[model samples]
Target: MAATGQVFLLLGSNLGDRGQVLTSAREAIAEQAGSIGNQSAIYETEPWGITDQPVFLNQVLEITTSLLPEDLLRIILNIEHDLGRVRYERWGARVIDIDILYFGQTIMDSARLTLPHPRIQDRRFVLAPLTEIAPDFIHPLLQKTSSKLLQECPDTSAVSKIP
Candidate 1:
């Protein structure tokens, strides 16, 4: 049997029914990626990078999976594609966006993916939800807990939990 590794995924949506899209993403992840162990409350956050787009609904999920990092990336890419994602612009509005935040303690920088997400400490949107569910989950390379990262995050963009 393959070893199951703990993974964190960040989900965001700014197009179509954002809440529904997030719900569908969770369903797809559970079916195609792994069993979800924990989930943060949904948050409505100001757009990052390209700020002209609509605000996004974001959340973080902790899951257990046996697939390796590359394979996991492939699965999530397919999940996004299946849910109507287009790559016309970077940080542009989308029906759904899923990002791999961490895969156990694995760290890698490659053309395809980066473990512990290179920008976790810089984005309040990512940190808010992540801190909610795994406040103490340490960034493999940063050597800081999620809560600490959230406190130190420099992105001034607003991030608020959805009621």
Candidate 2:
């Protein structure tokens, strides 16, 4: 195999055994891609966007993979579907939610996908754990570090670290 691609992903679950769903999603990512690298502590966070749902358990992980962005995305979607994630609403509570936060330093945007996920900088669920692994990781679009983005984010939703 070639050198694994460096990728960051945010995983969350707010329905049906949230913790177990997250762990299973992690396992699926590792199995379907290549290997799991470092993972951040899980977080219990208040729901954003759509509010009439359960609180979410979220975390970020650094994974090394040979899969391209699109292929990796498909794999994540498969995991979500397999784990019973319903595709009903935007920012709705889900059984498993997996988002590609960054693919190395690549910046891409298309009708179906966007690199450096558009909302990462605004969400504590994404940044809190990212800062743990790569506090200085630069946002390709904003040209700011993860720590800096976290500080600047206007989102005041509570996020608690969990093992």
Candidate 3:
């Protein structure tokens, strides 16, 4: 039997009722993916990659599942589509954005999905929430804990924890 692995996912929304959008996405995830684990509090963060978009409310979730990386990506894309996500531009304003951060320390680079998320080290928005929930979880590539990475992260983008 294939052992289930703990996966980390990041969710963000900057369009419509951001809070509700995130909540609904989380609900969908719980229903489709395995049980949700430790979750970070939402953080309102300035847009990255593209600066002109609305600030995003971001959170990180820890989940345990047996799905392969590619299968997980398909499920995520379906959920995004179901929630009205439109790919207008890279890093553009979005109704909801779901990213696979880590899948059981699996490191992979493919045309469709990238594990340990390629830009994680450079994004404070990602680091802040990840650190909140899994501060000691080491990066598979950089081998540094999330809190340490957050401390050394150079991205000056504002990331404030929500109430």
Candidate 4:
């Protein structure tokens, strides 16, 4: 049997019925990726890199998966495509965006993916929901808990919990 790994995934949607899109993405993830072990409350956050887009509804999910990191990335990309994501520009608005935040302490940087997501500490939108669910989960490289990272995060763009 394949070994199951714990993974943190960030789901965001800024276009086309954002809440419904996130709900659909979560359902798709649970069906195709792994069982979701935990999830943070949805948050409304200002656009990070490119501020011109619509605000995003974001949440973090803790998942248990048997797929390897690369395979998981492939699955996530497919999920996004299925949900109407179109790659127009970096940090562009999308119908749904699912990002792999952490994959069981595994760290690798290739053309396709990065573990502990390179900008986790630099984006409040990512950190807010992450801190909600995994406050004590330490970054393998930064050696800080999610809460600590959020405390020190400089993104300051505004992240608020939503109903």
How accurate locally, in lDDT, is each candidate? 0.93, 0.88, 0.92, 0.92
Q: Tell me which residue pairs clash in candidate 3.
A: none
Candidate 2: Cα lDDT at 95: 93
**Which portions of model 3 miss their true places by more than 4 Å?**
1-3
lDDT of 3 by residue, 29-111 (tens): 98887679899999999999999988999999999887888888999999999999999999999999999999888999899
How well does model 4 score by local distance difference test?
Answer: 0.92
Clashes of 4: 0
Which residue runs does candidate 2 get wrong by more than 4 Å?
Answer: 1-4
lDDT of 1 by residue, 9-126 (tens): 9999999999999999999999998999999999999999899999999999999998888998999999999999998899989999999999888999989998879999999999
Q: Which stretches in model 1 have alpha-carbon errors above 4 Å?
A: none
The TM-score obtained by model 1 is: 0.97
Worst 10 residues of 4 by lDDT: 1-10
Cα-lDDT of candidate 3: 0.92
- What C-alpha root-mean-square deviation, in Å, does candidate 3 show against the real structure? 1.0
**lDDT string, candidate 2, 1-163, tens digits:** 3545558999999999998999899888888876888889999999999988999999988999888888888889888999998899999978988899999888899887899899987887788988988898888889999999999988899899985
TM-score of 2: 0.95
Q: Estimate candidate 1's alpha-carbon lDDT, on a 0 to 1 scale.
A: 0.93
| CA-only RMSD, every prediction | 1.0, 1.3, 1.0, 1.0
lDDT of 4 by residue, 45-86 (tens): 999889999999999999999998999999999999998899
